[model samples]
Target: MPDARGSSGRPRRGDRKLSGDRAGAALKVLQITDLHLRDDARPLIGVNTEATLIEVLDQAFASFTPDVVLATGDIAHDATLPTYLRFLQIIEQYHHGPKLCVPGNHDLIGPMIAARLPIDPLRVGNWVFVGLDSHVDDEVGSQVSDRDIAELVAACPPIGEKRHTLVATHHPPLEVNCPWLDKDRIQNASDLLESLARQTTVKGLVFGHAHQAVEGQSNGIGLFGTPSTCFQFEPESERFAIGDEQPGYRWLHLYDDGRIDSAVERVACSFEIDLTQRD
Candidate 1:
C-alpha cells in the first residue's frame, strides 16, 4: 500500500565505523516478527510464512549485511518443538552474526527450556539487548513476571558511558489502540515502564505480535512494533482482519553517538489475499 521503504532516500555519511573506541559502533540491526511457522507444512493465513521468512532473509543478506538480528516473537504458529527447530535451521543458514529472540504466546516454554536457548540479557557492540518472556500459560494476553522485571532491572547499565539498551519482547508494553489486539497486549505494562523510566541507558522497546508495523514513544523512550513476515493485520481495526499492506521487516541503524534510526522494508514476494476467510 503505502511506501514500505522507511528510508528517506538521503544517506548521511558520518565519521562512524562498525569498530573502534567510539561512543558506540554503527550497527545495522534487523527486526522481524510474527512468523507463525507450523510443522504441518501448510501455509498459515493463506501465506507461506517459513518460505517468506527465508526469502526475506536472503534479500536482507544480499542488500544489507546487519550486525545483529532481533527476532521479536511469534516465531511459531503452535508451541511445537519441530516448529522451533525448523525456524532455527532457517536462521542458521542465513545469519552469521549474533541473533536474539524472545518468546511469543505461540512458543512452547517447556520445549524452549529443553532446547537450552539463551535466555540471559546480552550486550552487543554498543547496545544491550534484553530478552523477556511474556507468554502466559495457555492464555492470549501477556504479563511480565517478577523475575522478568528483575532481569530487566538488573540488565540496566549505568548512566554515562553505557551501552544503549533495547528491550525485546513478544508483547508490546504500550497500548496499540486496536480493539482485538489490545485485549491481548502485555498486562501490567505500566509497571515495566516505571522500571524503565529510571534507567538512562535504556533507549527503546521493540516488539512483535500485532502483525503490523507501528512506532511510538513512551516515557521518552522509542517504541517500535514490526509487521509479520507472512501476513499483516489491519491497523486500528475493531475486529480481526488482514490488511493489504506488504509483508516486511524493520531495519535499525544505531549511530556511534547514541542516535538510533530505523526503517521498514517490504519483502519481494507476490501473494494473493483471501479476504473472505476473515468472515
Candidate 2:
C-alpha cells in the first residue's frame, strides 16, 4: 500500500508536506447520502427530508468537523436546479470544506452540473477521492460506462505514488443483501472491481442508495454503504421496507498511513417514519 509520506518522511497531500501536528492528523470525511431533497418541503413517508437532513448535519457537526463533505447521491428528489441549490445552501451552513457528490437514480446530471457540485477527483491529505457517475437514464439500476472506467484508471496515482484512492458513486458495486436494492447494483460491478484491482493505490469504495448501513471487504478493499439522511430501508429484506431507524450519516477518518476508520451516527431526535407507507 502506498502511504501518504513523502521522501522527506512527512505526511503529504500531492507532493505538499503537511505542516505541524496537522501533518500527522487524520483527515476527517463526513459522508451524507440519499438526501432526496425536493423542490417543495415535502416529507418522504412521515419524515420531512430537508428537516431530517438539517438534523443529521447538526448532529454530524456537533461531534466532529470534517475536512470534506461527501454527498454520495440522490441530492435532489425533484432533480431541479432549485432543489440542488437549496441542498447546497443547507450544506454550506454546516460544512465549508470540499462538497463532493455523484448523481443517483433520482438525480439529473444537468441540474447537478448547473449547481456546480463537483464530481471530480479531489486530493485531500493522503487520499484521492474519485467520484463516478453510475446513473443510467430511465432506470433504477446503475452501471459504470467503459469511459468512466478508463477515466477512473487514469485518475489513479501511478504505482510509485504515495496517495491512496477512494471511489464514490451513487450505486453499490457490491451487494448489500437487500434483494430489491441489490437488483440496482452496478450492472458491470465485476468490471469495476477488476479495474480497481489493477490499480495498486486504490484502497476503498463508498456508495449510497442502499439507504442502510453496510460494511464489507471485496478484493482487499474496504466497502462502505451509508444510511440515508432522511429515511432508511430495512436491511437484508427480500422486498422494499422502511426501517424505524433514525436518519443518519457516516464519518471516515483517513489517516496518512493508508488506514481508514469510520462509523455511522444517527440524529438524537426521533422522526416517526411511516413504515407502512411505501413511496
Candidate 3:
C-alpha cells in the first residue's frame, strides 16, 4: 500500500523497462502462487487452475507492470513434464519479465529443472531475491535443509554491505492460525528464523501453500503468505475448509531505502466449489 509508483505517478505498462540496477527507483514484484496447474486442464475443487491463473495474470499486469514475476509454488497439480512445460508456456505468454519459481509439495524438481525456470538469486539495485527450496520427499510438510540454511546465510550480505535480501519458499515459515494448514509449515523454521535474525540485511520472506493471505514478523524478518490462484482455504479454519475468497496474488514494492510494502489483490470473479470434497 506504500506508494510504489513513487512521485512520478504510475509508470505506463511499458513506460520504462525494468531490469538490472535502478538504485534510486522502487522495484515492483508480482507474486502468483499455488497455480495447481495440470496437463489435463482439470479443475481442483471446482476451480480451473489454468483459467484462474490466466485471469489473475491478466488482472495483475493490467494494473502495474512488474520488474519480476515470482511464482512461489504448486505450479503443477500433476508434477508431470508436460504440465511443467505447459505452465511455463502459459506464464511466458502473459509476461516477459524475469520468472522465478520455488517448488511446492505437489511439484517435482526434476521436471521443474528440466523446464529451466530461474531459481537463482537475482539482484536489482541493492536488493537480492533468493528462492529457497523447502520440498521434502514424500511428505506434505516441509523443512529447510541444513545446506540450504548455510547457503542462505552465505547469500545475505553483511550488515554494512549495503545489500538487502528477500527470500522466497513454497511453505510458510510462520503459523497462519489455520491449524490444518499450519501443520504443513516449515518444520525447521526456527533454523531459518535464527539464521535470518543474525543477518541484518535480510528483510523479508515470501511464501505460499497456505492458500491464504498472511503477514507477520518473526525474529525481525517479515513474513508474507500469498493466496492461491485457485480456491482458497479458510484462513482461521481448524480443519480443511474452503473459503469464499476469490483467486488472488500479492504485489511487493521494494524500495531503494530498505523499505518493503505489499498487499494482496483478489480477482473480481469467484468460483462455486463443492464443500463435500475436502482434501
Candidate 4:
C-alpha cells in the first residue's frame, strides 16, 4: 500500500485519523438500505419497520460521516405515500450529503418521484454514483431496460478521468444461492451487466433486497449486498426464513484511485423476532 505520508516523507494530518493508512485518500461513505419503513402501527414480520429505521440512522449518525449516503431500496413497506414521506424525513435528520436512491418491488415510484427524493447520478470526490431502478411490475424480480442501461453508460465519465464509478440498485444482479430469494433476483441482469461492461470505470455495485449482508464479485467488479435496517434473511437457505442477525448497515470508504474498503456494522440492539413467520 502506498503510504499516506507527504512527499516530504512525514505522515499527513488525516493519516493519524485512519489506522495504518491502507485507506489512502478516500471518501467515507455510509450506506443504509432496505429500510422497509411502514406505519407506526404496522410491523414487518414482527419488527416495527419505522422504529428500526430510526435506530439504524441514529447509530450511523454517531459512528460515520459519509461523503455520500446511498439508500438502496425497499424504502416503503406498504408502498404508501406516507411511508415514503416519513422515510425522507427520517433520512434528512442526519444526512445532509448526497442521498442516492433506487426503488425496490415494495416501493411506489410515482409517489417517491412526486415527493422529490434523491435519485440521480451524484459525483463526489472523483467518483460518480449512478442509481438504477430495478422495480418490476407484478413480479418480485427486477429488470433493467436497454434505455436504463444506456443512460447509466452515458452518465459515466471517462474511467481514468472520473476516478471510478459505483452503481446502486435495489435488486441483486446475480443469484445469492438462497433458492427462494434467488427467484426474485434481477430477472434482466444481463442488461445491467452489458451496460457495466461498456463502462470500464465501475469499481463497485451496491444493492439491497436480499435482506442480508453479502460480498462477492461479478467478472472482477466488486459486488456488495447490504442487510436491511429492519430485519435479515437467512442466506443460502432453500426456504424463506428470518435470519438471526439484528438490524444493521454497511459502510464504505471509497478511495480516489478506484480502491474501496467496506464493512457491515450490526446494531447494538436485538429485538424479539418471530422467526416462524416468514416474510
Candidate 5:
C-alpha cells in the first residue's frame, strides 16, 4: 500500500513518487456517482446501470488512469447491505489508485454507522477530502449535520497554503435550478457555504445526486456536480423527469500550482436509447 508521500520527499497523488527532476506532477482524478444499483440485478430506466458503470470505469481507467477515484454518493438504490457490497466489489476491481466515497440518500446510513467506516474527512496529497452524510432516513430531503460541518472546517488545510481542498457529499449544497430537486437539496446549505466562505484553503466542492453535470462557483470556490453512471436528470427543466443524455463521469486534473481543470465525458457504448419512447 503506497502512501501519498513519494521517495523524493515531495507529495505525490498516491503511492507512486514523481521523478526527482520533474518540476511538478498533475493530480488526475475520476469522479463517478449515482449508481442506483439494485440487489435484484435489474436495470433502471431501460439501461443496465451496473453494466454501464462497469464499462464506464473500464473506459476511464484506459483513458485517464486517475490517481484517485471519488464516488460522490448514491451507490445503492435500496440501501441494502448486498447492494453496498456489490458496489464495493466493483470499485475494488476497476480502481488501481486510492478510492474515497461518500454515501447518498439511497444508501443505508445505519449500516455505515454500524460498520464504523470512519465518516470523517480524509487528507490526501495536497488536498483535503470531506465526506458528509446527507441522507435523512426515509425522507426525500437532505441535511448536513452540525457535527459534519465542524469536522469539515477542522479538516481544511492551513490558509495561504498551496494545497487544494474538495468537499464531497451526495446532495448539492445549492439550488440545481429544478424545483423538485432543489427542494431536496442539502438543508442548512447557507450555513455550509458561510463556513466555506471563511476558509481560504478550500479550493472546490464536488457532489452527486443531481445525475447531471453542473459547474458553478460558490464563495470563490469551484463547485461541480458529476453525472451519473446510471441515468441522467433533465437539466434546467421545470418538471421532475429523466433525460436521454448519455451516462458519463467527471475527470479532474489538478496542477501542482493550485490550478484545476475538469470536464465531463460521456461513456461510449455500442447502443443508444431513445428515452422518450413510450412503453
Candidate 6:
C-alpha cells in the first residue's frame, strides 16, 4: 500500500494507503461515472452501456492506471440489486486501486447498504476524497446535505499536510448551460459552495450524470463534470438531445502540494449510437 506522508514521511491516521502506487508520487485517480449498468441485455438509448464501459476501462487501464478509482453515480441504470452487485463485481475487476463511490438518483441507497457496498471517503497520502450523496429519492434534481460537508471538515483539515481535498458526488452543483439537463442539477449548490468556501482545504469538486464534460472554477475552487462511460447528452442544448461523442472517463493527478490536474479521455472504439433519441 502507498500512503501519502508528510515531509518527514510519517503516515497519518484514518488514511488508507493506496495499493500498487508509490509513496510521495502524485496520486493518480481515475473517475468513471454514469455507467448505467443493467442486469438485463438491453441497450440504453440505443447503445450497449456495458460494452462501452469495458472499452472505456480498457483504455483507462492501458493509458492511465490509477492509484484510486472513483465511481460518481448512476452506476446501475435499473436500480436493482443484481445490477448493483454486477457493478460491484465490475468495479472490483476494472481497477486494482482503491475504490470509493456515491449513489445517484437511479441508484437505490437502501439496496446498496443492504448489499454492504463501500460508500466512504478515501484518504490517500496528503488528500482525502469525500463522496457526497446528492441523490434525491424518486426525483430528477439533487441537493447536497450539509452533514456531508461537516464530516469532511472534521475528518480532513484545511491546512497543514492535509490541506487538499476532493469532493465527488453524483450531481453537479452548477448548471452546464444545457437547459434540459440543467433543470435536474443540484438545486442547493450555494450551500455546498459556502461550506467549501469556509473550509478552504477542499480544492475541487467532481461529479457524474450530466453526460457531458464541464470544467470551471468558483471561488478559487475547481468544478468539473465528467462525461459518461456510456452515451453522452448534447451540451448547451435547450432541449433533450443525444450526442455523437464517444464514451470516456476522467484522469486526475493529485499532487501532494494541493494541485489537481485532470482531463476527459474518450475510448478509442466505435459505438452503436442512436443520435436521434432525445429525452
Q: Which candidate, 3 or 4, would have the higher TM-score against the true structure?
A: 3
Pairs with steric clashes in candidate 4: none
TM-score attained by model 1: 0.85
lDDT of 1: 0.73
Residue 120 Cα positional deviation in candidate 6, in Å, after optimal superposition: 0.8
Worst 10 residues of 2 by lDDT: 10-19
- Over all chains combined, what TM-score does candidate 2 have? 0.88
**Regions more than 4 Å wrong, model 5:** 1-24, 113-120, 270-279
Estimate candidate 6's alpha-carbon lDDT, on a 0 to 1 scale. 0.76
lDDT of 5 by residue, 1-279 (tens): 111123554322111223332323777888899988777765565677789899888888887677778888777776777777777778779765566778887777776555343356666678767776787776667878888788777777767877778777789876767778878887787778678768647767778888887766656676778789977888767787887677888877776666667778887654445455312
> Residue 44 of model 5: what lDDT?
61
Worst 10 residues of 3 by lDDT: 9-18
Judge candidate 3 against the unseen true structure and give its global Cα lDDT, from 0 to 1: 0.80
Write model 3 residue lDDT over 45-105, tens digit each, in one string: 7777889999999999898888888999898888888998888888888778777899999
For 1-279, candidate 6 gives per-residue lDDT tens digits of 111133554322111223453424688888999998887877776777788888888888887668888889898888888888887777778665678889988888987777666787778888888888888777777866677667756765565555588888888777777778878787767766767767658888889888888766666667778889998887768897778777888878888877877778877656566655322
Query: TM-score of the candidate numbered 5?
Result: 0.83
Give all candidates' CA lDDT scores.
0.73, 0.80, 0.80, 0.77, 0.72, 0.76
126 in model 2: Cα distance from truth in Å?
A: 1.7
Give the Å error, residue 111, model 1.
1.8
Which ten contiguous residues of candidate 6 have the minimum total lDDT? 9-18
